[model samples]
Target: MKLNLNKKYANHTFHIDSYDSTSIQLHNLASLTLLLELTPRAEQLRRIIIDKVPPTFRATLPKLIGTKGKPILRRLNIVQQRAVLKAIAANEFFLIKGMPGTGIVL
Candidate 1:
């Protein structure tokens, strides 16, 4: 899948598009940039995953769009946010634990 992100953090309207973005660098960057960039491909991604884009990367929504990040952010209710946070925490544990062992209690 093709994805593009505009770097609003940069003084200029920096943009990049790639299918070659399969590397960890791209994945991590995209994970980081989800909230800050224009992310024109957002609607396309929503079809595949809810909150597919992380909030950390959204560009401050221009005044026109409302307080950056707060505007276009997927309107996740409190319960949803807590569930997502829990999932992310679990994923972090999985990554840090590396290969699970028999010691795993669950």
Candidate 2:
């Protein structure tokens, strides 16, 4: 079987040479080893994962007018509205944990 790693290594083709229940061997071990080395993309990802980069607070919640010209947020419950506001105000990352059917999106 042939395998493609990513867009950066799309030109290189890797073949499966051997396989077992535990592991699979590629025909070109050198190519696979190259993937272990860190690239610029990997470095940026590491920084973001470690929170070394500054938070991005560019997004804002949109104001949707209802049929009666009332703001859509006014219709949401206080807790839901607060959650949405918190998510919009997040700079780096925001995580919302709730049970099923809690009306929380992402």
Candidate 3:
């Protein structure tokens, strides 16, 4: 992404450095957003942290056990994945239950 603060005429030109959104990052961001969306206002001010992410995990879960990208968590059950996501969203969720450290949140 690039921005030009130059004042020029209609014949002027400009160039951007470079930028693009990766699917992995997009997926991660989307998942995080969903977590927030799931959280309610009452729990908004607490300290929360995501502890773990399971291997061979479902993309859009709380809805299903197996899934993938694009609308990742869309077709799954919103109920199950709700609490964890909600708590995180509220910023009151903490101490992830089963994270073995690396390979989680990727």
Task: Estimate the TM-score of every prediction.
Answer: 0.19, 0.35, 0.20
Reference-based lDDT, residue 102, model 3: 24
- Separately for all candidates shown, the number of backbone clashes (residues 3 or more apart, or on different chains) is 10, 0, 7
Candidate 3 clash pair list: 39-86, 46-91, 48-93, 60-73, 62-77, 63-76, 63-77
The parts of candidate 1 lying over 4 Å away from their true place are 1-22, 35-96, 102-106
* Candidate 2 residue lDDT tens string, 1-106: 8664687687887766645533334544654555445987555556665556754554554554223324756777777776667666776566667773285644
Question: Candidate 3: misplaced stretches above 4 Å?
Answer: 1-21, 41-46, 50-106
Best by TM-score: 2
Which 10-residue window of candidate 2 scores lowest in summed lDDT? Answer: 61-70
The Cα RMSD of model 1 versus the native structure comes to 19.3
Candidate 1 lDDT at 15 equals: 42
- Candidate 2: clashing pairs of residues: none
lDDT of 2 at 21: 37
lDDT computed for candidate 2: 0.59
Question: Of the candidates shown, which would achieve the greatest lDDT relative to the real structure?
Answer: 2
Better by TM-score, candidate 3 or 2: 2
